[model samples]
Target: MQEYSSQAAYDRGEAVCVIGAGAAGLIAVKNLRENGFEVDCYERDTVLGGLWNPENQHSPLYPHTHLVTSRSQTEIPDFPMPDDWPDYPSAAQMLDYLKRYAAHFGLAEHIWYGSEISHIEPVEGSRFEIVVKPAAGSAARRLRYGAVIIATGHHWVPNLPSYPGQDGFRGTILHSSQLKDGSRLRGKTVLVVGGGNSGIDIACEAAVNAAECVHSVRRGYWYLPKYLGGEPADYALARLQRRPRWLRGFLTDRLLKGHRELSARMGMEAPDHKHTDEEPIRNGRYLEHVGDGSIQHRGEVTRFDGGEVAFTDGTTVRPDVVVLATGYKPKIGCCPPGLLGVDGDSPYPKLLARMFSPRVETLAVAGLVEPGVGALPIFHWQTHAIAHWLHIRKGDPERAANFRQQVVSESAQYAVDSTGVSPRHHLAVDAEEYLAGLGRIIDTLEQEPAK
Candidate 1:
């Protein structure tokens, strides 16, 4: 690879380069092609589907991983999943859906599997120079493109927490991503850490599979059941958005009152912030398991001693396996941090309207937001707007300038910092507000240019 470093980059004028062949990347390719731009999508792994595919070495999927967001809400707007599929599809089904999407849109030809964009930087103005590093031991190739969209998602890197004495603890410790099979918990006393969806789900799995299950939650979180009002919970709640604002709150409260009371009865603390502020835990069986004494819910983890874990509530548990379902950190390793408007030491990027870069006009990120809803539709609209914006920028500078202003104003209006400071809430955005912003941007991009 070093031998090829001195060679000039092969310039593909006007072609868009999409990093990662996951759902977001595939959508970007399809949208770019539809908007009459040539596209080249690169996937570091041999397979597509990103984290959805279990074969991907960095996949964060655990045993029985299913969609927290329901089918109607989760499906891509233009490419719906099968009608007969379950409301909440499994991880395997998601991979199958992504494969079908790529095939149906003829996106595979534009994809370079086993190739990664090792580095990318602005070359001439907004054009980008990218180093295409092959997974094989082949010489790395350099290419230049008109623009780049980074779809390499944030779930690959696990956010493991450190506790006192963790290094010498006698039990085995595993991040949620590493606990790929339920059999690992069988007959063992399992301690699941974190309060996110993954933690709750894995704890439920442990409740059924392990001899004992102790769940350590650091803070309170909204816990919604999988179903409400005889329909999928997310879909039902989303439908309420169409109702009058005055009626919406009342209806939402009525729907959630039972679950809220149930959580309180189980000795769980009420969430400090609104449910929309963060991704809520949506597991139906977790509370039931706790009620039945199959799962013991404990406070935050304090420390680790020889074969024992201490909690904030002064309780201690000796578990054979400790699973840390602490979620993932948002990281874009290929591109320079400053290019994504990363200031100081924060790993998360400060984007324009949560998609476009605040610094570079031609660099954008997709699927980097936690919208507390189905992210697939958000990815679809984001790529759609990005593709249209790129097309407009190439042909009409006046419209592009106006569009950029709209993005800046919208970004300012929905600035996420006002929501919270927790790293878990860093990428959080209200789904309704964000989708409306995306719709406005798309509408502006699609409008006729000055005659």
Candidate 2:
């Protein structure tokens, strides 16, 4: 392999391992490699691009799939997406882009594919041990790293909250994960549950072929168009959004107003959920932006009957099939509790600003922050943070310790973050600003001394 950007100063044994080769994981790998760190990426699948790879086991890529966010905002920092690719890249395009990235940087050899990580726990201070088993074999092997990153980004499992009478439904029901094509729903009445992007997309597909379609959401959502004018809707807001929080909120409000009809038609109501959910969007024109009167908007599903979906507002719709797009639960259980050097699910303080494991400062996690402006932007920022922290520890441990001291308190209450119903705990930082801050930190550390 070619020599890294920093060779002699690079720390060995202090090898870092990142799980999953998704968008965030790949970015993390690139940054760490640039710092001359010996990084190993363990991927459960045989390919790059976690959800983008369709042939891998239980991956996400369907004929109908297209990037919800535009290529400009979603691409990695150094590698600009190919000029020939569509403005909104497809899943296959993204997969190819990642493959190219790995090949260009000679990262494929460093990756151990088809290796499923079964468990992870902290060992001695500043170190972690991971138990991994090959997908085709029965044998398990233990590998230790200076730090292990759980870039195994979310969406691994589907979230199906238990509700009344779900078992009573006689017709076939599938989660968004299983519904790869709209062919089966061609002549059937379909009811889509949820208000997120996936739900919106699924409904769009079904309306094209289904006998009829209904979109059900608990409350209203403000959705942004994928594109406005010729660029991404969120791309235009980049300038106006840099203002103070109050001013940013004003711009957010104006964008939602433009998409109100489309949002309402797609089962997204007004007031509570602003268009684009306050996320930045590219302004582009779309046909049938509204539910088209073909996809009816019904607020929330109360329960299910033999052939009926009841709602919280005492309304009910009889549909042939229902597709639930509820989100997923973060799976930290696979990792041991003591990994944090503390007991419980709460994140560690005083370590890479609560981005890495404090118990094992070498260990880091990317893609944990919930989507701020979709998953890619936030995950990109997280990957950047992990990489910067690794560089600091590699050059000088004492200097890094001082920086770690700044984050000793992760929460205002010194309380641990839980997965329960709380938005603030997950989305503490503005994602775009966080990425910008991350870039600045890397630049700063590159100039800082080893003292």
Candidate 3:
């Protein structure tokens, strides 16, 4: 095969380019197509399910990984998951659902598998020039598109923490992604680090499989069971949003009171922030395991000594294996940070309304927010707004200008308070607030033009 010069890009006129064939990307493609735009979706992996597919090298799934958000809340609004499936579907089931979605909407043909977008730069007339690097031993291809939506997601890069003497510690250390099998934890004294959802889930896994399980955390987080009052917890909680504000709070507190007391009884520090401020840990079996002494909870790790780990509480644990479920860093390496409104040295993108780029009009990001609910429906509405925005920009200049102001005003309503939260929670948004914002944006787009 001959290599072509990187001089000219193959022009794809007015065709939208979607990066990543993940659930978000697929939804964007479908929504854009529904809005009458030609779309080309690119997936770096050979598979289309992104992190949901275990075959994807970057997948963070471990054994027995299930949806923290229940099925009714997690499914895409237009494309629901199977009715017979469990309320909390497994990772494999999620992959299957995504595949069915792509097939149902005829989105697979539009996706270019094994094609990774290496770089993107805005060219003349708000169009984008993309460098596509094939996974195979083929020459890089240059292409141009009318617009770009990045759906690459934020879970690829592991946020590993370093402790004193970590390099010299004489024990096996693995990130949650690397611990793909439960057999690795069986019969070993496991130490799970971090306090996020993955850490809690892995601790529960170790509680049942490992000889002993110890969990370490730096800060307290609100923990909620999967169900409340005999219904899915999120659904039950979300239903209160329709009630009066005063009544809603009273009802919410009543639902959460027991769980809060249980954490206190287990010697766990109460969360400093409100439950709505950050993503809460939703696990039914973790507290039970702790109660039974199958899982021991400890404070943050202070240092790593030879074959031993010391905690901030002056306790030391000698574990045969350490698992770092420290969560992931949001990364979009294909585009410039400045273009995404990233100021100074912060890695997080400061997008307008948490989706569109603050600086670039034609560049947008999808599925970047931690909505603390089923993210699939959020992506559906987000892409719906984005597609309509793009369509308005193309055909109705007057309405588009007004809609831009509306979006700016809508974004101000969601000014989040990230105080006391980790940098990883920088992208976190109140799901209720975000959905309300998305609804307003969608209504603006779908409503009839002024008479």
Candidate 4:
């Protein structure tokens, strides 16, 4: 449990500090470390594998969790899934895979677990100070890094919405981020609100274990299969031989649009969420819940009285525990209250195209976005691009302007998806977008870094 000796010299090159030892951070660190940068990874959790590890601190997120995304596409590059393993590896297995990745690539020595980075501020000029709080007896420490990558993937903070009785409720209420397993909810009636993947998973878990389960959604969503012909749906879509790229986009949109049209006809809610509606994530398993009947759909939580949760349809239901499978708020520390120009009223952390803080420079956030492809790949792509631009190639004035413009253009092009939908992009759409982004990063690195 020893620490690396602190250096006094500023010319010791850059310490590329990455936050969140999750999938994205691990990938970023592995690549940056291999690229010969002095990399330090920070994770608040004792164990690695942010989403893969199951802990009570996280409840229902643990048990019965099989990855919906295929093992092949989900794994890190150069690391293939074992043939003997199931198509969709369980959370425990994914954790094992991550452990293997760390060992195989010798990333364990570079990572500092249970260490939470509190802030990344411009100390004086281009240099940045990364302040972190060690998990235990160690006092706070600071490292001066020339560049920092906020690969602290988006899902850590729970995006829960406040409801009427949330405060005075006698029952326990928490978000999916707080969900670890179904142990505590044993025999207790649980109410899961939201229609995302987490909401569906929690409802299924509750149905199997809880006394009674109810799920409410403000609108309906389109559900797609995780795989087609034994390959991931996303992978299959990419390899579609019969269609051209334009046709694929057209056909993809048509298929999604068709599902929405059909859902509306069947007395079920359609793809139209609120106009200001939080767009449904690109996912599998929405209609499956209705078919399974695990979740009794209440319209929406109109209000609540002590033990009863009233719905928008004027019906009332009382439950022992109310779990807001609602989304997570971005975990930005004590910073100024500001908003984005794109979405003026929203907070500052909501970046455009996952970069361009619009105010902060030498500080770039890479993983707050959601792409159709998956956070696994998109986050790495973002970190790869942001880290390269900020650390490895910071010197060129013209290139920096171009980088900023590209980010702005990318944000505008994807603005509909970002501003209209949730911050994350659908995985199917994101795969290609991020791959292109990564390619651009590779191209940009040829110039000299800002000294």
Residue 198, candidate 3: alpha-carbon lDDT: 91
TM-score against native, each model: 0.98, 0.84, 0.98, 0.81
> Model 3 segments beyond 4 Å from truth?
1-4
User: In model 2, what is the error at residue 200, expressed in angstroms?
Assistant: 0.5
Using TM-score as the measure, name the better of candidate 1 and candidate 2: 1
Model 3: ten consecutive residues of lowest lDDT: 1-10
Q: Give the TM-score of candidate 3.
A: 0.98
Model 4, position 20: C-alpha lDDT score: 74
* Per-residue lDDT over 1-451 for candidate 1, one digit per residue giving the tens place of the 0 to 100 score: 4656788999899999999998899889999999999999999998899989999888888999999999999999999999999999999999999999999999999999999788999998899999988888788899999999999988988888999999999999999999989999999999999899999999999999999999998777788999999999988888898899999999999999999999999989888887777788999999999999999999989999999999999999999999999889988998999999999998989999999988889999999999989999999999999999999999998889998999999987664443344465888888888989999999999888768
Listed per model in order, the count of residue pairs whose N, CA or C atoms clash below 3 Å is 0, 26, 0, 26
lDDT of 3 by residue, 361-420 (tens): 789999999888889998999999999999988988799889888888888777568666
Per-residue CA lDDT of model 4 for 1-451, tens digit only, reads 1342364423324777777777777887877775667888888888777767775134235456777666665666557668799867787887788888888888878888888876556666656676677879576676777666666554656666777766777778877766666786789888888877677778778877888888887766655556544567655655553588678767656545654554565445666532112323333454555556665777779777888888888887788988888765455552233422234545435565655466556566655654444355565566666656654445565777766766666654443342234433331234455466556655766545455
**lDDT tens digits by residue: candidate 2, 216-244:** 76654445677654456656555556689
Candidate achieving higher TM-score, 3 or 4: 3
Regions of candidate 1 where Cα sits further than 4 Å from its true position: 1-4, 417-422
Clash pairs for candidate 1: none
Question: lDDT of candidate 4 vs native?
Answer: 0.63
Error of 2 at 128 (Å): 2.2
Q: In candidate 3, residue 424 scores what lDDT? A: 62
